[model samples]
Target: MPELTQAQRNSLAILLDSREERIRAQMDAANVARTVSAGPEASDMADLAEQGAEERMDDAVVDHYRAELGDIAAARIRLARQTYGVCLDCGEPIPYPRLQAYPAAKRCTPCQRRHEHMHAGPDGRR
Candidate 1:
């Protein structure tokens, strides 16, 4: 894999740092919400219902954010290893513009398209 240009590595590092901070904040908020939801005060019927709903929403949001964070962390590790923009599936250099747009992307468009095409059949059994 080609080493990231110094400028590219710098850019990716900044983005990864920002993403990590955002994910940490999100996880913190989720943890607080979870704690609140489980507290004895939440046992009141009205409080229980509201907390349940909020907990579900928080769960979904946290899951999404956590997955995105994992991707960003992986990309950051790749950057440190000088392989940040290489497509995992095709071994192609992912375009810089695409990386700028989605700094955590693991595959180039062609590889992603092929992957999606292969797995998008009915029943998703590919």
Candidate 2:
């Protein structure tokens, strides 16, 4: 396989930057959630409910960040294997614009659409 081009290298840099940002955000969210949970108990039912909701939201944000980090890690592995821009399903080169928009993409648009369609839930979401 050919080595990454300059544009691909730039995209990889973006992925690395994004990974750092996500890790920091995830850690911040986790720390805030921990601190809030360890603080004084809520004074009332409404306050307790509000605190619970906030904790759940924090957990969701952390989960999102973790998922994105996983994707970035996978992209890094592909880069190491010299297959970063190739569609995993079709073995075709993923477009540069798509990679620019989503550096961790593992499939070309058409293949991605098909994969999503095949895996989508009854409500049409993946």
Candidate 1 lDDT by residue in tens digits, 1-126: 454688887987787788779789979977986876575666578987897798788888888888898899799788878778999998899888888878899999999888888888698644
Best by TM-score: 2
TM-score of 1: 0.71
lDDT of each: 0.83, 0.81
How many pairs of residues in model 2 come into backbone collision?
A: 0
Question: What TM-score number comes out for model 2?
Answer: 0.76
Candidate 1: segments with Cα more than 4 A from true spot: 1-4, 33-53, 117-126
- The per-candidate count of clashes, in order, stands at 0, 0
Q: Which 10-residue window of candidate 1 scores lowest in summed lDDT?
A: 35-44
Q: Kindly list the per-residue Cα lDDT of model 2 for residues 62-123, writing each as its tens digit.
A: 78777877888888888877788899998988887787778888899999999999999999
User: Which regions of candidate 2 are displaced past 4 Å?
Assistant: 1-4, 33-38
